[model samples]
Target: MGLSRRQLRLLMVSGFSLFLMYIMYSSKGDNPSSLSDSRESANSIISANPNAKIDEAINNKISKLYQQEQAEKAAEEKAAVDAAAGIKVTEEIDAIEEDFDPVKELMQIRALAPMIVFSKSYCPYSKRLKKLLTEHYEITPSFFPVELDKHKHGKLLQEHLAKISGRATVPNVLIGTSNESKGGCDDFLNLHESGKLATMLNEWGNKKLSVKRLETPSNV
Candidate 1:
């Protein structure tokens, strides 16, 4: 028996609705699985052909640079302490002969005097030198951090020391009471090796005291 037109239309509508539901269900169920598969594929690619080493190298260099800078700052702080505590400097007698203001001249002389240093933040030898000086002499001396040549006078000082004192190294040292010693880390070590560091320092300290006493006479 043939169906009526309204009955056929109603049946067609119901079938179409069922087909659309099935399509929607299939899409929803497959999407999650498809996404998971894609993620897994990407992970495999990364694992098989890793390319982030450049990033690691860059990061390592950055970290190393930061560490170096921090170390330098620490050394400078130590030096500042040493300087404030009184490290003597010596200048050429003839260099400032023309305009010798005793007050200012004395100040410059103190600044240019021989100083003992242990280490600079940027120099490895400076570390070793500092340790030796501390262990052998029990003095920290004045510290100088020659990392980037921030003090323009350092060049001139280095040149002067090189030309006059014949020593030109970051850890170079001058010892004795009058600040007359001119040597470096090697010299310090040599003195320690010879068991003369302590004796020399004592003698130098005595001389230094006497000189200062003479320089500043008492009313009595």
Candidate 2:
């Protein structure tokens, strides 16, 4: 009871048409115009190359996936470029002459050559470190010292220093205009031990800084 070849062809075409109807029904909430165009294209493929409809469908899906991947890669590259651009944001700001801003004053002092030590007159840590810098190194431009206890806006400046540098204690050392702290007295000693202090001072002070003359004792 074998069916004729014409009858078999008719059955296959009818089954494929039912499958396409099921797909269209399932894509109900999607863009109607896009769906209509896809339906027309699928019909054209089926009409010209009856056996290739399944392959064409698979190829369309693969093409859509490739486009999505390319879009995601483009987004990631744009994010990377945006991050690089943000890295050059200026730390310095402009202000008026009459206005006495504590933060501005802090920036001005921190902007001094060689380095700046925001110290207290009575703090033994400050005394010891200052002595080391004066005796051991011939820093050309010389380091700037801000005696917070002697300043008019002492408490106010210290409060703001803590806010910016994240160091609340005496002997806060800033080696750059950006106010990047090099920690306190103990940290400075460690820098000397590691031989980075002399190297840094040479660049900032514009002179070859001398190495530690002797091992001074103070756990400040």
Candidate 3:
């Protein structure tokens, strides 16, 4: 029998709802497969570029190694520099300790004699002066010879002598007193050649005696 209009309308509405539900279910099922296919395509693309991951890993490892090597090298250089600095400081300290006082020694030597010869044993000029003073002159008692190379305060004395006399060599002849007269080998030779050395020595000797007399008390 033919349905009434209301029943036909209700039947049509139910059919349409069922059709919509089936279509939504089908779409849901297709979405998962589509996503899986997309994932597979991405994987295939990555696989085609096989060296990409390897290159990245290699670069990272090499970079890390390079940084480590640089750090080690820097540390070694710093250690070397520190060691060298330490050695230099130690040497400087040793030099300071070994240095001598020149002024005090010079004063003491000057008091010892009026005619002082600052000489080195091995120097030719010093030998010449010594020979001339000892052999040619009779001034042994007043002649004072200082062998600079053998003396403990030699270097200091030499430096001080250089500052005072503007000469930094051996065979430095000092006459009368420490600061009174200064001459080198050439001056000594000149005096000897001119036959004035003996006269000069006699004069200085008499001068020393006069100085002593002046210093002595009148009653004594």
lDDT of 1 at 36: 74
Window of ten residues with lowest summed lDDT in model 2: 89-98
lDDT of 1 by residue, 4-122 (tens): 75576456555655564554334334354577776766666456443354345445655665676688889999999878655433234345443434434223544643343422456
Backbone clash pairs for candidate 2 read: none
Stronger candidate by TM-score (2 vs 3): 3
- Tens-place lDDT per residue, model 3, 111-188, is 888778899999988888777666556664557899999987688788888888677888887766546445767776
Evaluated against the true structure, the overall lDDT of model 3 is: 0.69
Q: Looking at model 1, which ten-residue stretch has the lowest summed lDDT? A: 211-220
TM-score of 2: 0.46
lDDT of each: 0.50, 0.69, 0.69
TM-score of each: 0.36, 0.46, 0.50
lDDT of 2: 0.69
